[model samples]
Target: MVKKYTVAIVASAMLLLTGCSQKSDVDASAQKGAESADSKLNQLGAGDGMMKLSDEEMKAQLIKDLEGKVESVYFAFDKYNITDESNSKISANSKLLGEGKAGELKIRIEGNCDEWGTDEYNYALGLKRAKASQDAMIASGTSADRISIVSYGESNPVCTEHNKECWAKNRRADFKLLP
Candidate 1:
């Protein structure tokens, strides 16, 4: 009986040690996995060497990197059709917005007009212009769900001077990025 009791105690201790060692092994593997993920994020520009950014932070960084890179699609004074020159701009913008970090963002297409017509007429024209640009972007492979249109009419002109150049600048569709 005494021998049996001693053997039982020894077996219990061995089982306990085995369980503890398995737990430690699991912990080690989990740590390794976390480190691997962090390294991958760093490689993708989503993290510093030591830490990962939150989703909002990464989006803000992407927006900052992409600012001013997208060119506006300019329009003729009374037309909403996409011109050849405007088509090139739209193609470039679409390519830029369809790849890498920019692909994950939403695009806001702001349509503007010069001070040449009534407020209602300008607003309608601006909306039509915005729709034309949006269609162009979609045709160039950007997702329709990711693009939104807004008409600013004559209220958001980049240049307010009374010249043809200034008016031309105002008659454009601007691109804005959102998280």
Candidate 2:
């Protein structure tokens, strides 16, 4: 009975000692960090930090800054190779991308095709065309990381008329800018 009583007393004393211990520095620092983060979030919500633009505003700004500055690279029918004529266009685009706001923006190369081949074939061809343009841009000093490729195939045709001129217009790679 005495041993049991001593053990209970010792356990109670240990509990009391632990309960009375001071908070650790880690706990205090964590609390301080949480408060600092909350304050920063509040400041950001109140627009005290850098200005943020709305999606529409950003799109308009991008259009204003880069509309028609980058030209579409046209490819020959049933071909994905960058021709001699397209080199001039690629060089001009690289120059534009190297300077001003265009340099900082990410580029999307959209590959388009005429309604001549099967959907699968057109998609593949379009992808190849986009890849070719991407390679050309990289060769002309544009960072490959900044450029992305997408193939719209025949779904996004610039001209819908079933004619040579219209099909020629549709076979192209167009550049888009992203924030």
Candidate 3:
């Protein structure tokens, strides 16, 4: 009887130990998963851990924000000079560039002209308009080295109607962020 009782007690102890070991293994697995989640959250700029976004999601958000900061300044008919309103807008762009909000991105100033002039003349006028905007940005604080100029001439019209208002809209300088 003593031998049987000792055997029974040993079996029970072995079973109990096996169960505890399995539980410990499960706890360790859970801890590893939690750590992985925390690491992903941190990479996405989520310190508070309320929500987590993937790397691609974070990148898209950043790109959208940067695009919204881009500004376009318009020009008067037969003129490449910057108006007061356009100057203020260019100043804002300069501030953004100087503050590093736009990162190390280069800018393209696209000059466009109304359809009233000959192709060659319109092209020159468009280039002048682009240069005017570029100069204003530089004067307001943007680095001249990071800017480029292009003239689309009267090729790309924002409004197709043959009207004064449409022509005014067409004679404009567009800003583009280059890679």
Candidate 4:
């Protein structure tokens, strides 16, 4: 009777310990996934010595980074005033461009428009958008010589869903740096 009782107690303890270990392992995995998600939303996922990307690497990464960093202020049919919301995004990109104490890079601002406007009008509007971006870059300490502007009008759109919503997306500027 004593031996049987002892054996039963030992088995229950082992089972409990195993279950607790599995629970802790699951908790650790959940924590890791949450950290990954936070990195994605806030900034580029980087770690250790690899976090500091080189100037060449930075230049290569600018186009994609700027796409997410820069916000386009929508105009009412035909206008060029920076909105309050857009100002914030511009400010962030400005800091990123100005603060990096590294090699100077060349950037091209490509302006675009939706298909609703006339080709010529859209070309000019696109130019206005490019000019706006170029001016902002200059204000951010990027040299004028390093920045150039081009207008794509309605010819090239990052999105082509072909509606008011899709057209709005095309009516913006793209910032690309030479890598």
Best by TM-score: 1
TM-score of 2: 0.66
Error of 3 at 6 (Å): 34
Local error of candidate 4 at residue 170 (angstroms): 1.3
What residue pairs are clashing in model 3? none
Residue ranges of candidate 1 with Cα displaced over 4 Å: 1-53
Ranking by TM-score: 1, 2, 3, 4
| Candidate 2 residue-wise lDDT at 82 | 95
Which lDDT tens digits does candidate 4 get at residues 21-139? 99999999888756364655577555566778986676667656655655554544565555666555555666665545322556677888888876698899988988887786676
Model 2 stretches astray by more than 4 angstroms: 1-59
> lDDT per residue, candidate 2, 1-179, as tens digits?
99999999999999887766645655776786463546665655555436778767776697566757789988888999999889889888888877875687888999999999857989999999999999999999999999999999999998889999999999999988887
Clashing pairs in 1: none
lDDT accuracy of residue 157 in candidate 3: 94
Candidate-wise lDDT, in order = 0.90, 0.86, 0.84, 0.71
Model 1 over residues 1-179: C-alpha lDDT tens digits?
Answer: 99999999999999999999999999998886463546655667534645778889989988877767998888898889999889899999999998987998999999999989867989989999999999999999999999999999999989989999999999999899999
Assess candidate 3 and give its lDDT: 0.84
Two-way lDDT contest, 2 vs 4, winner: 2
Off by over 4 Å in 4: 1-74, 101-103
Q: Candidate 4: RMSD over Cα atoms?
A: 14.1
Model 2 residue-pair collision total: 0
By lDDT rank, best first, the candidates go: 1, 2, 3, 4
